[model samples]
Every structure is written in C-alpha cells, then in structure tokens.
Target chain A: MQMTKQEYSKLVDKKSPPSKKLKNCIFAFLIGGAICTLGQLLMLLYEKAGLSETQVKMAVPVTLIFLACVATGFKVFDSIALIAGAGTLVPITGFANAVLSPAIEFKSEGHVMGIGAKMFSIAGPVLVFGLTAGVVYGLVLSIFRLF
Target chain B: MPQRTGHTLMLPSKPSVTGYAAVVGKKEGEGPLAQWFDKINEDTTVGESSWEKAESALVRDALALALDKSNNPPSAIDYLFAGDLLNQCTGTAFGLRDYNIPYVGMYGACSTMALTLAQAAIYVDSGAAQKCAAATSSHFCSAERQFRQPLEYGGQRPPTSQWTVTGAGAAIVENAGPGPYISAVTLGKMVDYGIKDANNMGAAMAPAAADTIKTYFEDTNTSPNDYDLILTGDLARIGSDLLYELLGRENINIRDKHNDCGLMIFDLKKQKVNAGASGCGCAATVLCSYVFEQLRQRSLRNILFCATGALMSTTTSQQGESIPSVAHLLNITI
Candidate 1:
C-alpha cells in the first residue's frame, strides 16, 4: 500500500491536470506583442508631441509605470496578467506592479517596516542581478578599451 | 463511555453540535455556497484596515454567531479550540482573546477545522467539559502575502494551485443537543510522499487523507456504503482524485460516497480558483453551513468528515523539505 515519493509524484502527475503551455504561449505572444505595439504607439505619439529624443525616451517608461501603478492600485493589473501571463510580466509594467504590490500589501504594517522595507521584495532580485550584470559588462568593456 | 477502537475513539456520549455559523469574504460570497453562509462581508478587509485584523474579525464573528445561535453565553463554554493559517495562529489568538474563554490554539494548517471539532467532541465526550466551541478561519489576502504572493503582485497561479478561501466557520459542541452528534473520531499520523512543490498541495496532502480514511474504515470495520457521505476538507479536485486512486489501491472505493468541501464551495468554471478553493476555512465554512444543514434536515444521517492539513512552513519548503500532512476524521450521526 505504501509507495515511494517518486512513485507518488508520478501518481500525482497522472491524476493532476497538465498546464496548457501551448495555449498560454499563444496568449503570451499575442498579448506581449500587443503591449510592445502599444509602447511603440506611445513613442510615436510622444514624437508627434514634439518632445526631444531624450525626453521621449524617459517619457515612455514613465507613462507605462504610471499606468501600471494606477492599474495596480485599482487591482486591475492582476486580472490582466491572469490572461496575459508573461505578456504583462516581461515589460516595465510588470516591474512597476512588483514594486507597488508589496508597497500596498505591507502598508498596513506601517510606513517604516512595512512599505519601505518590503516594497522591493518581489522586484529586489531583479534589481540586484540587473545591476551586477551592468557592472560586469562595464568592467569588461573598460578592459577591452585599454587594449 | 469513551471506547478506543484502534485509531478511532468511539464516543458513546455522542457530543452533539448545537450551533454553527459560517462567515466569508466577498470572493467566497460570490461562490455557489453564498446563501449557506451566515454572514458575507462584501469588503475583503471586513471594514478593518489590515488583512490580519480582518481575518481575526472573521473568526470572532463566526464564533459569536455560533454562540448566539446556540443561546450559550461565553461563560458557558468551557473550552474553545480555534486556529488559522497565519503564523503563530495569530488570527485565533487575537480573535478570541476578548471572549474570556479558556482557549487552545491549534495548528494543522487547512485541517484545523476537523482537528478542532474532534478535540471539542473529545473534551465533551470525556466529561472534561460540558460545552466546547471549535472555530477556524482563513483569509485569502492574509494567506497570499504570508504563503504565496503579495495581493497586487501580477503572476499566474498554476492549474494545480488552489485558491485560499477567505472565510471562517465555528460550531458549539455540548454533551446534550438535538442530535447530529459526534459518534467517533480518528486522528491521523503525518504522511509525506515527498511532494516538494508547494503549489501542488493536493498531491502532498492526499496521502495523509487516504491514510486517515482507510485507517478509520479499518478501525470501525465499515465500508463506504455504511455512511451517507465521506466529506473531505479542502482536498479540491486534484487531491480528491488522488485520494480515490490511493484508496482504490487498498480496495476502499469511496468515490461513490465522497464529496470535497473545496469542490462544493466554488464554481470552478467561473471562479478561476484553478483546482478549487482551499485553506482552513474551506472545510470549516462548508461543514458549519451545508453539511450541518443537511444533517439537520435528515438528508445526511451518517457521515465521516475528514479535514486534511499540509504541515510545511515557508521556511521548511524553502529549505527543500517535503510537505508532511495529516487528516483528522470525525464520524457524525443524527
């Protein structure tokens, strides 16, 4: 009557439903493409507004982050991501949500220990690795320039 | 007289459930069992500023309602067994602190309802207490941040993952009542099948549930057909299937008589609850509402209520430890 963990896991896998990865991927691609296209459209709109290249470069992400924050506050981003999957995740909007989410969740604990400390809980790993990779790339480029 | 039959405790006194109440949040209020709940809070916060406090309020409201229905004062209750999914069982501690009742905080994760109920019945059956109350709650918002993710975090839950029911249930058990009595009880041992994936809790807890149910049947010399129902707490779709498979191996076919509180609470097609609803509240609220109602109506005369719990903390899981689970069974008869 007793089964090993491996056997039990197999049984569990057999009984449990499999994830629809193909369907998820298709949804992710469509929604991700749509999000990127929206970003491109925003860039074009900013250009039409006669903003400088630098200003437009900063404005695009700022606008997206602002929208993400607002959507997160209204609890709409999670619903969107439920269908969009990684579509909304692999963008700047996802990062905004990651940061703002804990900020909102932990705010009950108080400003100091709650929101301030846990604000980056989800996005903290990304920041650490991203900054480390940037530094490593800069170091490699600087050493190559010396040659 | 309390007679011990292997792992089952035969309660000859048959401590009866006198009062019961279920309180749930907005999401659960929209579920199929909405009408069954005594009170449904449209606000997830339950008018509280924090989710932890709100969860406490759920437990308090449920216990208060149950006591109110039983016409029992707080001083009349000798023991109160309550617990929740929060760390250190803060929800129960805070919720019942002001009630001035002798409180016993319990921790069995999702199986808390059955654990509390069985203990309450034991206390009453053994003549240690004339009256006892069992209560438990689980808040989705509180559990999400503590166990899974932040409320606003944008991520997809796996198909096997179950949603925590934001609700609470309470019942008052006494030596004398109008029936629907606790006739027997079986407390399960920890069973681990090395399920490391926290998302697939049904797989982790199913082994324990199977072990407990099989043991109960063996101890009592009974079969699935002997009872009107075999109700499991919060096993949902995947765990229930696994339970069937595991029990099938032992020639114990409960598929015909079985129903999980998780599956009964929510409509999976519309609720987006993946496999089904989970948490301590899943079983607690269902038992306190639907099952008790059915018992009262004589629709379900005899039943076995088994609540399953996964005993793995976040730290243990993060340290690569497999989940060990338990299931406590209570045989109730009207």
Candidate 2:
C-alpha cells in the first residue's frame, strides 16, 4: 500500500525526540545575538573604510556577498543564519549574502552552469527590479523638475 | 452462454474537483482591526483575551460559511486538517475540537492553508477518504505573544514588517460535487534567499512563489491564461510587485488576475495593517470568507491558490542566518 504524505510525516516524527525545547530556545538567543553583532561590525567597517558615502553604500553589499560566498563554501553560513533570524537580512548586505551563498554552495553540481549561473538564483530578480525601479524613479524626478 | 450484447461500460472520467476558499476574522468591525478604521477609537493594541476569543469566533464563522456553501456537515467530514500561526496551534486545535471532529494538526509556517488543501485533495482522489475539511487560523495577539512578544511590548517594526491579523478560514472538499474541486497540487522546494531580516518576509517569500508558480505551469502544462485567478498567500504590496516582475521574465503575464490575499484582507489607511498581513491565517481567512463566497456566487471559476511560507527557526534568526521560504499551490476548478 502507498503511504500518504500525512502518514509519511507521522512516521518521520516518530523517529525524532519531542524534548529539547529549553535547550533549543537558549541556543537560539545566544547565536542570534552573536549574528547581530557581526552585522554591527560590518556596518562599522563600512563607515571606517574611509570611502565616500556612495562608495561605502556600494562596498557594504559587495563585502557581504564576498563573505557570504566564502561562508557558503565553508558550509558555515546556514548554521549562523539559523540563529540570527531576521537580524542578518535587515541590511542590504544580507540580500547579497543570501544570493551569493546559494551559488557557491551549489557549485559542486557544476561550476560553470551551477555556481556561476545559479549564484543569482534568488538575487537576480531583486537586482533587476532595483535597477528598473531606480531608472523609473530617476526619469520621473527629472520630468517633475523640468515642470 | 451467449456473448454479451450491446452495453459498454464507461469508466467515470477521473473525478476532477478543485476550487479556492477564504475567511476573514473581523465581521465588519469589533476587533483590533476596528481600531485601524477609526482613529478616535480607543483600543490601540489587541488584548490577550481578544486573541483567544477571536480565534474561536473566526473558526466558527469561517467553518459555518464553508459548510453552508459546500453543504457538508461536521459528521460528513472524514478528517479535519487544521493549523494556526499561534503557539502549538492552540487556536486551531482548541477551536476545531469544539466541533467534535477528528483532525490532524499540521504546521507549515504561513503555507498551512495550501498545504492542508493539497493533502485533503490527495486523500479524496486516492479513495482513502470521501470528504475532508481543511482549515487554518491566526490571531494578532496570539501570534505576537508566541512568535515575538506581547502586544504592549512596543518595539519598532522595520519597513518590511507586516501586521498579523486575527482571523480563521476553512474549506470542505468531498469525493462527489458540483462545486469547484481541487485538481492538482505542487509542493515547493525550500529556497533560502539569505534574507536574515524577519521584517521583510515579502522579499524572502516572493522568489518561492515565483519558483512554485513556474514549476506548476511546467508540470501541469497549463499556461498563465488558463486560470481566471492566481492568488498568492501574503505577498502584500512589495512582494506582489516582485512576483509580477519575476513572472514577466518567463514571458507569463499575470498582471490582470494576479492578487495577494495579504493586501486584500484590510484597508491599509483604515485598518493601518502595515505592509498588509502575513501568517498562515492571512490567506486562510481571506480565501474562505471572501474568495469562496464569490466563487460560489459564480463570480469565479478557475483559481490557482499559492500559499508561501518563511520556515526560519528562532535559532536560525538569532544566528544572523538568511530566511528560507517555501510555497505550495492548489489548482481549483469549478
């Protein structure tokens, strides 16, 4: 007889322990706070890099993507991300990190097709929208100024 | 014995049934949502009692509406597939139990409604069950207390933050029916877009919705124009725009019929639901109460309901990890 998804879910649950609720909560608090600290450090680095405001803005996201790619290669980002929750994603850097990490992790499937192409798997559309919206906004602002 | 005569046995064309449903929490006024409508009104924050009370009320209201339309009773329901965005699914569990129907509790973050409907349809089609009732619920106070903190906590929310609505919705699917039936379901493959901020769930979930919608069209050989409506769970405003952009890349235009239940549930100006609403209950309440009613009234026919979810754990969030999301789609045909 074929087992249903519900039945399969139940069977899987039987193998796992229901306990460890407290330990999980404690770990989440500590790890999540630590991740936020890393984000704060990155923000400081962006300010102290002695670059102009515009360059700092660009560098922040770029630096995050680089770090995330490295972390993805080392298989350490997912664990850290798990604890940081939304703290890691609030910044623009988090978005870059998320995009590049997946590409690096999936590189094992095939670098040219997988890592190189898929790295933008999630971030591709965001960049497209950002660029498109930016151009539209600029055009609208210019038109308004002419009036 | 002589050979059989002219009678040909015709097999029933594989029973195809699919449709969408939604339910809303507030009945015109009288909840936390009511305060959003009138600035002069008192209740700024939802109370603890309101959460518990609203969950039960919404469950009853949504279930009654669904049953009246489906013409099915509590007894006819073979299984009650239900869940909520509350702690341990308290609202759904406690509320559903009052009906005295046996149900299996499920949790898939915000994707509960679509997931439950998909599971129910599978059971009916496989002959494992004749009828099933799928339901999901959410309450603002309950969700805040469990997921974040108390309503009085008064923390500043990020721009991407979405308000949680207090509501519930239910759908009933049967083996035989003239009503719309569930046709097909596609479970999403979890995608982590590295969104560490919980505030902007729309960005995190939009990609999942695009991925699932693309896959569904591919797997079923159905084009975007084939359906009258393609609804996403909680894309709200920002995510809705993102979804449109993503689908455009595939040469699929969903601009006309595409809508987000999160954006539809409340009036932003009146209700002050910032960035609209999220959570499993957001789609559940809207689809059952509003969308299902319209469908039954013959306003809608074919609908593709895709519910999206952020599956990040508190542990992952604390670790500054990115958010992973999943989406599930149910094709409903009238």
DockQ of each: 0.76, 0.02
Docking class of 1: medium
Predicted candidate 2 versus true structure: per-residue lDDT over A6-108, tens digit per residue:
4423432342224344654565566546555665676678789677878776776666667765765565655555444454444443575656665544544
After the best TM-score superposition of candidate 2, give how far the Cα of residue A108 lies from its true spot, in angstroms: 51
lDDT of 2 by residue, B122-221 (tens): 7777677778888887767557645663232212354456777666667787777776666667878886655566777876787788888888887666
lDDT of each: 0.94, 0.66
User: For all candidates, what are the clash counts?
Assistant: 0, 42
The TM-score leader among the candidates is 1
Error of 2 at B58 (Å): 3.0
Model 1: CA > 4 A from native: none
